[model samples]
Target chain A: MIRRIAFNLFAWTIVLAVAFPLFWMVLTSLKPQFELFRRPPTFLPETWTVEHYWTLLSSTKFLTYFKNSVILSTTTTLVVVAIATIGAYSLVRFRYRGRESLAFLVLFTYLLPSVVLIIPLYLMLVQLGLSNSILSLVIAYTTFALPYALWLLRSFMAGIPEDLESAALVDGASRLGAFRDVILPQLLPGIISTALFTFILSWNEYLYALVLVNSDSARPLTTGVMNMLVSSFNIEWSLLMAASVMMSVPLIIVFAFLQSYLTRGFGAGGVKG
Target chain B: MAEVVFKDIVKSFGSFTAVHGLNLTIAEGEFVSLLGPSGCGKTTTLRMLAGLDFPTSGSISIGNRVVNDVAPGERDIAMVFQSYALYPHMTVYDNIAYPLKKRGVRKADRAPMVQKTADLLQLTELLRRKPRQLSGGQQQRVALGRALVRDPKVFLLDEPLSNLDAKLRGYMRVELVELHRRLGRTMVYVTHDQLEAMTMSDRIAVMEGGKLQQFAPPNEVYREPANRFVAGFIGTPAMNLIDGTLANEAGAWRFASPGITLTCPPLTDDAVSGPACLGVRPEDVLLGEGPIRGQVQVVEQTGHENIVVVKIADGIRLTGRAGADHVWRPGETIQCAVDVSKAHVFAAGPSGQRLNRPLTKDQPRLAKEGA
Candidate 1:
């Protein structure tokens, strides 16, 4: 009984340790501006108000930034997943020289720190006349997401038996038809997971969004939040925490529903004798 | 239905050859099996016939039209893979109807055709289920139904029944032969199991090391193997091969080894008289009173007959069948005999080609009765 009590205490301590920041953020977001700067922080708000959420929803720039984030992340995910699926499928199925090295190179690029690419990507966006545009952020996010997406999806494609495509060919379907009809359907889980990962990465991204876009017309939520931190000397803690809570809701909802597909080997029962 | 011919086909992957200069003509309405061990290029040959893998050189013609440059989709050949390769996301009905859908067949026309195929394979009850929900045998039927729905000119099955249980494999073998007769289409099957090839194929092409060893009807391949490899490969428990040298001793043809000698059947004048290997089937290894002496190693009773394993000489073991009524034990001395007429003599070389050609059409068994 004593050991069980000790184990339960340790587990709860870890859970509360991880969850306390979010708990505090919610409490602070609900508190009025006066209670936030108190010397002794209030564990729970004495007076709750929806004014911060109301202000955020009413502000036109906040809505525009939210829309920009949705557009950039969605476009990045679709483009990255499509290109990575095709690139991964070709790398796994077709025979060519330097395929192993090419796959290794993709992984190498995926492992590189994203900070290393920011300056060069910024310069490239300027050259392409896409600076200060959402297109620049979309292009930059895809460049980073594509390599990891290819690496993950390639392994998933390899698990699928090669015989499925060969059987499709022998059944009088063309090569592209076989890939579309047989391979792509089985790769659905991998593709979904890739899309989720790329979308979340772009949604949470700050560096590329800050350096590339300059104005409210093209700014995403990440840059918009950072702009709020510096635009006023006295930071609006309640408003900032409220915006942070809203930004994280979609990711939580995606994970809650599609969590099973994120587990590896989703194609297990897809092929058998 | 169409006849498929592979003329001087060679398939190589970079420096290594998978099939070397293969020439085979599969007639319409006939079933031929390419039988060999794994890595002997049987599956590669079947893949080439299906146009999945193009040959490194040489042309293939189907019904007198050369398909050298034709893609697999345009070739009109249906294949069943070893893994079944059923479309897992689709139901049985959709799986069977995919080829027709690819060909732009009307949806109304495809339903009855898929239904007919499902009925043919006895899979009508499972049309609504996905492949993962079905048992292995059911999955196999779905694969067959998928191929049968197309009504292609040729059917290529690459070890289709290799994944089934033994009893189900036997049952499906009979079903496949009946299906062939009902459809009367040209079929080419690939398998490593000799029993599957022998029992199902009208003709068997025995291959080894990327080359054809012999191509003949099933019984002929059994009775008159062209080389030692075919003789050793085609039978259960394997044909007994005893290495010896042929000599003209006292003006009589004889084969002599370390501990045994037998009168060799007459060979043609052109046959070489040097080192040779003698082969005899297990059932022909008579185990009564005979000149050859051996020690019984083990006796196994397999329902109908008992298999007696005997160590004939140093490191040479021969297996023969005895009646279940006859009792034998391990470490017992036994005398055996072989009917000289049933013995096969092969040249002792890397090729192991048959060296003995019988001089007459009819040759009686020249061993003592009930020896």
Candidate 2:
């Protein structure tokens, strides 16, 4: 019993060590401006305040950046996940020459660094007259997000038994009908996890957002939050912390609701029947 | 019900031919089993009949209409996969109703059909439960219910009972036979178990190495195997085959081996005097009181009988069945006799053709008595 308690204590210490930055961000976000720089730093604020949050909502372009981030991330996630699901299904199921090579090529694209493609993507977006817009960010994000999502989903698709589809076919369903009725429902857990991963990837992405979009109106939270810290001569640490705390709320909510499917999805992939 | 036919069907996967030059005509309402070991193309033939696969050449027909170009869904057949393959997301009712729904049956009409099928399979209480909620036997019944709900003209089953426990397999065997009797639909079953094929099917098609070895009723297959492969494959404690030579001695036929010689009964005109294989089932070998002598090697007690293995010569063995009451032990010298009336002679080598006439030409009479 004593050994278990000591082990648990050690485990919790590791957990707190990892989670300490997030906890400090939330605490600093709630502290008053003067309290942030106090020589004997306080664990709890002497004067607890929402003034940073209030200013972030009303006095700055924080809401505009938040809205842009939401639109850009959601659109990129939906489009990438939609295409990846069908592509993964085809890669795992249908028989044709070069199918395996095509799947390999998709994974190969993921190995290329995002920074390497940013200049070409910027030029293409500008040529298409989509520069400095949320649309450009969505396209830029797909370059990295699509390959990752397809590789993850392809393994998930391979985990389902081929007998199920053959049974559906002999039961009088067309090929597409069998896919809709059998494959899609079975693929729901995988789709949810892939969508969540894509959403979070787009939500936290920085490089393409920095390189592709320059106008303040279309900037996402990554650049928008950085602008306040870098562009200002005197930094408001409290407000920056408050923005960090706010940026993570959507991800926390998503994680809470889909925790089970995320574990199941990861467990099912790459495991043969 | 419809008659199913395969005419010169050949299936090739690139350069490897899975099935070769197959021709079969399954009569209407007949339950035919394609029996063979693994990789013997039995399942491939069933898949071709179901339209899941198309033959590389030749044609397949159902009810006298060529169905080579037809889609699987339009072929009016249902298949029970070896895995059961129940939709994991759907309830039993929805699983059974899916095929009807695909055929555009009205929802109200579909309910009665599905309910009737569920009731027939004793699955009424499981209508609302998903497949994962049921036991293995219950899942098997749901698979059957799904296939039965359509009332298709033909049913294709690929080793459906192979996954069941031994007791359950035997029980389901009877249930399937009854189901076939009631439905009277053409059923093509694939299995490697000879007991299952012999007990359940009206006719058995024995295949090996992508070729049909023999196609006959179970009794005919047992009594008169067309080749050595069938003779060796179809019996439990398989028929003991001894290498020997047949010779004609002054209007008498004699079979001679290393340690023993036997005078055989009058054989048909097809019997040739040359190297041959002598096949005798254990049951037909009398355990004691014969001219041939040998020492017992091992005795296996099977409650009702003892399977006795005797070494007649160096590297030559013969298995004989003895009554359970008569105890025998290993290393005991014994005399046994071959019941020549029921013995079989085949040409030399593996897959040799049967060279002697069957004891009785009573296949049709036996079939009539069986019915």
Which DockQ values do the candidates obtain, in the order shown?
0.63, 0.42
Judge the docking of candidate 1 as incorrect, acceptable, medium or high: medium
Task: Please give me the DockQ of candidate 2 compared with the native complex.
Answer: 0.42
Q: What lDDT is obtained when candidate 1 is compared to the true structure?
A: 0.87
Pairs clashing within candidate 1? none
Candidate 2: stretches off by over 4 Å: A260-273, B246-254, B263-275, B361-371
Residue B217 alpha-carbon offset, candidate 1, angstroms: 0.9
Residues A1-273 of candidate 1 have per-residue lDDT tens digits of 999999999999999999999988888889898988888877888899878888888863678888999999989999999999999999999899999999898888878887898898889889989999999999988888899999989988997899889988877788999999989988988888899899999999998888889888999999897796446567778899988888888888877877776674355554674
Candidate 1 residue spans exceeding 4 A from truth: A1-13, A260-265, B250-252, B358-361, B368-371
For residues A67-116, could you state the per-residue lDDT of candidate 2 as single tens digits? Answer: 99999999999999899999998999888899989988988989988778
Model 2 steric clash pairs:
none
Error of 1 at A246 (Å): 1.4
Model 1, position B297: C-alpha lDDT score = 97
Q: What fraction of correct interface contacts does each candidate retain? A: 0.72, 0.51
Model 2: share of native contacts present? 0.51
TM-score, cand. 1: 0.95
Q: What is the C-alpha lDDT of each candidate?
A: 0.87, 0.88
